[model samples]
Target: MDDMSENAKSEQYQEKTGRESNPIGVAAVILLLCICFLIDARVGFGALIGAAAGFFAWSLLKDNGTRKEENADDRVAFLDTTVLQHNFPLPQNMPIPYAVLDIRGHILMYNEKFAKEFPNMELILPVVEQLKKAGIGKHAVVVVEEKHYDAMLNQCEVVEENGAVGNVLNMTLVDISKQYELEERLDRNETVIGMLFLDNYEDVMDSLAEDRQPLLSAIVDRKLTQFAADANGVMRKLQMDRYILLLSKGDLETLKEKKFDIMNTIREINVGEHIPVTMSMGVGIGGGSLEDAMQSAKAALDLALGRGGDQVLIKEGEKYLFYGAKAGEVGRNGRIRARVKADALWELMGASSSIMVMGHRNGDLDSLGSSMGICAIARAMGKKCRIVMNEVSTGIKCISEQMAQDEYYQTAFMKEKDALKEMDDKTLVIVVDTHRTSMVEGPSVLEAAKKIVVFDHHRKSAQDFIEQAVLLYHEPYASSTSELITEMIQHIGKRIKLRSIEADALLAGITVDTKNFAVKTGAITFESAGFLRRNGADSIRVRMLFQNDIDSYKAKATAVRDAELYLGSMALSVCPANRENSTLTAAQAADDLMNVTGVKASFVCCKVDDVVYVSARSFGDVNVQRIMEKLGGGGHFTVSGAQLKDCSAEEAKERVRSAIDEYLKEETT
Candidate 1:
């Protein structure tokens, strides 16, 4: 049947089904329409009607065609999806290695192959981006983007059907969590490193003038930043002057290697005003964990500071490593603050009756002056105070003689046997200008006193007598012990009757410590000096106290003339004289020699009896404390000293030379 015949037949079938007729009736209607259109031209109109009737009769054919098209679309979709699923071209029965998931990461399908490979695996998509966002990206073996399906899906063949473009997305899942865990375990087993925040950064920077603080801070920050960068670690300023660094085990060795440069680097930063800024770095390596490393670093840092700043000290397994600090200068502070410590100190001291005041061996002006000042206060409190001395060096003879002339300021030069007899539970011992228990003039005095109070301006030491002292007033930044004592007297009252000789002694101490106001004299230093001046400390009288005997003056002049220059900055003077206090004389000569055209630092080595003593001074461009520390001594950056026992003066001089050479080598690069 043709088109008109087919439609008429479909129409006929519909009408016949409604009227309860069979296929014979439908065929008759189809024949009638076909005959009408074929017989006459006018009957073509009837053929049109017949065609419409045939169209209606054949509606099932149209439905069948629609169904065919729908089936084709479904087949095409299935083929596209299959291509993606089977992108790897593995055997038909091979298990897929990854779960098929939708865009939302939910699993849509899992092949038998995938099930076999990851039987217990969750159906999560386990994509790279998802892992990275969750901070577990380190375990990812491969990263695939949705757009790079052709590459990520193993470059499976493309199938073109109809006019649609489709992509294959085959993802492989690799479980490397075990590997990551193993690496983490290994890292834990390796050496761990930690850092110190280096407290009082502002205090260090403020040691420079107000206008110069920023410059110094920038210099310091830049060097530290660069060092952190070199270590392949991240360093951040946690606070104003505090920093936190995360370093790997491998990078810690670099820190140890560059230890010398670190000291040199810090000491090189200038503020355009005061001394150069330096740091005391403590490194802890090979700890059980990062926390232990941090604890060790803290301990090492305290050691450095206690020894005095401007050196690198490392603590590992109870062993210590010290580096840099060839200049041997302990920092000086002329500033003085009132001795009115926390109320707790007064209460602690008030609990005692008889008090003893003492100082380091061969007490200097500052030590004696501070003790005298304390004695006056003790007298005001109606307490019996005795100044203890091992032996007078004659350097402080005039002041000591005058104080002795006044019966109230009594001296206890009796042997230790006698001093111990007088000591009792009510005795309060005040140690001035020294912290080390071994350095005190009379160790028994400290051992005998029931309660000990320590006031010192020097840097701390490992041998500090902390447990013996109930109260400690140690300020490494202060200028002199005399200045601190002077401040305490002011708080007690001006009516404490400070004698002219006492005032002179205090001023001389300040002058000697500050090197005639050349370095380390802060605002508080001059203020203290001014206070002493007002209390009748005549400049001429103070100057008279510093004037040595004629022979001693000549020795000082000769020592300066024989000084040798090192690194265009440091001057070294070796004194072989048997002068009883040649160490002090040589140090004074070095200080005087610093005024020479290009001298930046001065070191004086002198032999006293069997011990070779070295005294160092600096313009803040060098770290002398580190040098002294290497010889088992410690002090501040601007002034430091060390004693070389059982070594000849020549051997000591050679050691000094070697230290200077090493220091110069570090600075050059």
Candidate 2:
């Protein structure tokens, strides 16, 4: 046993680089085993016992090394309060709110500046406990109009007193007075200035007895005056039905916070006798100057009324925020002086030796008819005039046939290549009907022509051609481009013998666009139709122009059968494939479907190749123009169109449905 112990110790010393000797316990065991071995030959077991004792000693050394590594922190006390007190001291007088607390959520000290600034709550230990219990210690909790404060004491640091460990919390409190003040000022200054106008005010007044009419005027004025007072704003009765308001900017935020209660306020206006009342409001704000803001506000109001009444439109920069759009349309009255002025300028167009009248791609009746009228005027001025159109849709194929019968107009449909051949610096291109740059017949023609003129009646859209043209006449409230051009003809030299073909073309445009004077027909619409009748535009020929092939009629019927209604007022018809003019045919069929049971508005969609086209219609009971405009399209109050790229018929239908739902929700809630 003694020999075995000695050998084991020697090996252990070698493996450990001779660092230490074997333990005394293993040596004593080895000595006892050696005595036992000396007594008996079987005592050779002493070597085994000594080896086992040596192994146990080695295991104890390994465990001791591991324990030292794991419990190293016990040797160096981490909590040192004296070092912290000297390094981190609470500020004596900090502007921002600040606090100091000891561990256990006890407030040790607080800056008076915090209390002076936010005196809502007395900062004490009790308050700290209350705040901790509330579980909003780290949140920005404040009573808006009332005074309140939330203190967060989350700052934690280790501290030691006489070698005893503890924690000290140092936190900074913010008065937040200036922040609340600025927010209050911002809220107070956020004004939503809007203008309200009575629809067809003159017509309504004229319909009343002379004595009662003045009473209605006074009644409207007094109600508006009271309403403005309620909003803490100044009201101006600019016209019989038009009222201008100067509202408080702060009230605007409050109104928005109340979810825009102006809608409900309008519904509550009591007209003298029992009468249904509705108004179109335009709102604008956030302009650097008040005057510019008011101008924007007025423009928005005009658009709202122009689109039909009983709606609120808020204009911000170039985009619009629309609301409360569910209202029936009343008749629109607009001035034609602008169109007259545009036509008078045409005579002065003699500055250029020649003129070209162009329409948008796939020229419709209104575009073609309006361009023909302008062409006649240019020729009368002794300047060579040409009509530039790339394609005529199948719906207007008959009208194109009639235009070809006239030699004067036959030379008008000049292709882009042919038109470029005749193009020069002295040429003026007159764009008719459509105003969007994307919808123009040929963008290259516009780029080539330095001098341009535009005449359109569709509502303004994102891409307007007005800025590019030398002269622009855009009347959104007008019935059609033909109607606008007819008014312009009155100013041009003695209304020239309206050629039978020219008259028919103009009448066809009015018929196709107005659905034979059924939609959006106003006093001027009737007046223009009467003049065309005198100029040899036979109604029989106009009706014949609308007749379509049997297959097209069948397609129209199919679209009608597939029509889907939305908002209890709109219908959608989708045609995925058709070689004919499916969009136009579907639009007509949708209009016819409106007479069925409960439909008030209609939309038709058709897909050609990869592009999808949508046509919107209203029975004067709803305004589909705003809905279509949201989908990147524009037209009159009752009719509009849009094109969607890379979309299936079903996807387009779903989008239109979402728009309808959003629009109705805006009007109702």
Candidate 3:
């Protein structure tokens, strides 16, 4: 093993010297071995070993000499070179820009290409800091001279002869401006799906003269075709009153810039009819695929139709944008759907073990009346049912007391807490009057119930709807939820009878919501009232229910007396602060102001329990729903109310005025 180690060392020494094994050394060793063999054979072996040891020692000396020579050359190479001389060299003619930055992101050196691209180090300082934060072997995109570049950063060490090292970052930037532009162009050209449905098409056609019908249809088609052509889109007629549209995102942007004037253009076309034609459009963009885009378009179209048509709804991912929601919902031809919904409700009730009916918080006459009507239906269906209510307004206190005296209604009422305790999987919850979960009497009840149903007359909220509803009966054209319930009771059967007081309560609800059947009272509304009348609902009794106490009367009078007029046709009234029954007083004041000639809209603001409430009423020309929505409340186009928590009456009034101003501004624009 020792001989092999010596031989390996000798070979390494020869390699370092850049020379072959010495022939003179080998000849001396061979001659010594020959002399030992001639002198004595036994002693010759020992002499050979000694000679080999001496040759190994001589090879070690030669290896040391070669290493010393190399070290001397390395020292001489650095003797004339400074640390900066070794570090500072620029690739002046390189196409790719490059830079060197110290650990603190201060630029030490840069190539000419980098200097030309970013003449000021200040502009590149942020990029350098970002690259330092990203550490080494990572790329960052940065803009220079209005062009994009992908910069790769690398950390390197500069070693000196003294064994000291300094750290620096080397950045190489490659231009990516053209590639980014290409990607943007492709994105803009991606396809978007849209659906268009003619609003009130059947009604318009029925009203038009037969001879002019075809001409009007042709005109509409030609205009729609022209509209699509102008946007470089494709449109195909899907039905007599519906169209499917496919357009690029770029074309959609152009239409957006035009503010979708096709809606106005179609409305301007007249065919010897009092009602002009209108259309609703729903567009979907930024979906993952064509099928996904089409599904989004379908959802958007459903929203548009549900919002009374003559509008546009655009769906992009989870968000939505709306346009042209100025028109009121068109009256339907009949109440056929109400009968269908009534039968469905009856079936659902029969299958359930018990039913619980609820309404919005601070249960008003309308909400209470609707809840009672549904309870009456549940009783007729032979299902156990209870009305869930924890509080009653002062205005309905007398009626509630009267109902509590009756044997049938003695055990019919339950609080929200009690109702939740008794609930089971077979329990069905019928929510009435209000569809928003925030306004419900008890959201927990709605959340815990396995089967849910909704009956509401208010316009659907764009957000915050009853997502768990299995059956939704929402009719924006109806005057009141009580009216809807009355219709449903009639369809249930003649045998399912409402008590005289129940009838009166339902009739009072319709009267209050419709302002004594003077506003938003359609033929169906009156028919529903007639059904309640036949069941022994007396108008005198209903009127008696609305008769306010002395203090309420005085509060209402004061609110009317303090009326302020604005916008030439609107009246704003504010009730006294900290008054009893302030909500009812404000509503009465608003109704009274609406009676004044030339007062197209009326708003009454009042403070109640740390919250300011505004009761809004309009006379067809103004959309109170839009105004109220601006204040975070929603109802019908002509009647709506809002509650402002922790606000003064004066602040509430100002907010109402501001909402009115904004609404009018939007209308004009």
Candidate 4:
């Protein structure tokens, strides 16, 4: 092996050769191989090849090193890479850019193509840094001077004359710039299908004057026409409330750059008390076929509606991008959908041997009440069902006490293990209050049961949702899952007696989620409450269910007292740990902080065990849901919560503040 290290102790290497004398090194290596051939010594040739490969083995693999020199403890170890090329020679006249690198990623040798492609040695540093960070691969993308190359990195081993061994990297780059350009051209021509639905159209029209109806319809179409024109796309009205859109992938990207401000433009249209019409757009791109794109658009539209409309949702491959959900929903789903869901739930329950109802962990009033409401449905259907409860929280203590006193309820509840043991393929699992797969108390039952049903009022989480449910009833406009369940009982179309305790529990669930009917309440919310009241739901009893003990109350007061006002309108607090009801306490503290004048929103964080819980509340001005969503949480526009793991209480508080900052920044942007 020729000694070509940048820091060779030999006086001949005092100045870098800059490839001026590389041909001489190549010639010397060739002469050695020829001399070995002339001697007709096959054993000697094999030994020489093994020694040359072993030397390279040491140079490239001295130790694992990082691109960031500070993070790498291994000192740079360089060896002659000429011996490596002798063992694995590249074609001298090849048009590809080829080079050899030492263990420290210093380019020791390169061909003419390599010099032409990377005129400056610094240009190759990014490629080397990327390769080191991601590890060497068969084909790696390396971009130099805005040109794309498919690079191949191979390791070579060699042994030096002094018995020292090292490993080096042999790299070859193939220009793929034209291929990428052609792909970009095709993407610019690719068709993307989109659906635009007029959210709250029926309600807005009902409130509009008859004389302005035609003008309002015409204005809506005119605005959409302009929107389509700006993007070089076309739209067709499919119904009074639905429109089909055709756009190119390039056009979609243009809209994305502006965050689809068309949603805001459409909302600003004013027409005789019928102005500010909300629109939801769903775009489907990167589909294999036009039909696939259409199906994807339909699914995206459903997701956008489930998220409360006034937004645009794009589905590309398996990923989703959202924009413009600043406005709240003004309409709840009609009763027809509820009736259809009720019928479907009954059929599924009849098909299963037993049913298991579950809710989120650390059962709250909303979760407990919703599970009991599911039990009421199962009882009406004449099916055996049990509520899965891992532990009780302070919010459900009153209803839990009542449950224990009932003889029929003795076997109605089971722990997670017992539930899993009794569960089988014939069991139908129904989850309430939460749709995220990780939040449920009995996770094993979800996988073991043959069929699963989900009933939730929270906006669907973009990630970690229950995708395996056979039937999912998600209504973001409803006050709580208990409210949805209450509606289901009335429409189940079966005569069954709902015990007073169950009624009280359902009322408590609704009360907690709605904050005693102060926020997130709608016509259906009050209607559901009215139905529960007729079934013997005592308002005084529901109030008692939410009454916290002295310890929890003290924690809430301390958190509120120490709350810091953020950016003038928001409050941030850190609650003391109350394990039995820390989440409940945090939520209460946030709600109490919202009572302060000028405080539009509040966030309360508490550390319970290893998990840091955060509860957020807003008084219609600030959308706490979007802020919490930034921290991997989802809820209504006025109420949301998140839990963080592997972080201290101070860290959690900082994260909440950062999320709030991001939310405010998004507003100004």
- The numbered model that scores best in TM-score is 4
What lDDT tens digits, residue by residue, belong to model 3 across residues 1-669?
Answer: 999999999888667665586789778878878988999998899998888787678768877887777667654543323443474566778898998766666666778888888887788877777777776898888876688889878887766655545666678999999999998898899999999999778778888888988998899999999999999999899888999999899888888767788999999998685488889988988778999999999888876776667788899998887777767776665468889999999999999988999999878889889988988887786776798888877768878998989888888888889998999999999999998998999888998999999999887766778977889988877888999999988877885889998999899989988888887788989888998899899998888888888988888899899898998899998998676577888888998999898999999988878888899998768888888988999887778899898778888888998999998887665
- Against the hidden reference, what TM-scores do the models get? 0.60, 0.71, 0.77, 0.80
lDDT of 4 by residue, 1-669 (tens): 355553364444323222123688657777877777778789558757975896557434442222234222222233434454554455667799988887778887888888888889988888887877767765788788889988877787755443445677878889999998999899898999999999888778888988988888899999998999999999899999899999899988899889998888888888777647899988888769999999889878888888888888999877888888887765745799898998898889889988999999877888888888888877877887899887876667777888999886778989889988887778889999898988889887777878899999887776788988999999888889998888888897547578899999999899988888998889889998999999999999888877888988888899999999878888989999745788888898998998899998998999988989889988767888889989888788889888899998889989988998888887776
| Model 1 TM | 0.60
Model 2 lDDT per residue over 58-77, tens place: 76787677556544542243
RMSD of each: 26.6, 8.6, 13.3, 13.7
Alpha-carbon lDDT, every model: 0.67, 0.71, 0.84, 0.83
In candidate 4, clashing pairs total 20
TM-score of candidate 4 relative to the true fold: 0.80
Model 3 global lDDT (CA atoms, 0 to 1): 0.84
> In model 3, how many backbone clashes occur?
0
What lDDT score is found at residue 332 in candidate 4? 43
Alpha-carbon runs more than 4 Å astray in model 2 = 1-178, 190-216, 237-243, 253-281, 305-312, 323-339, 415-427, 444-452, 461-471, 493-495, 565-569
Local lDDT at 350 for model 3: 90
Q: Which ten residues in a row have the lowest lDDT in candidate 3?
A: 75-84
Candidate No. with top lDDT: 3
Best-to-worst ranking by lDDT: 3, 4, 2, 1
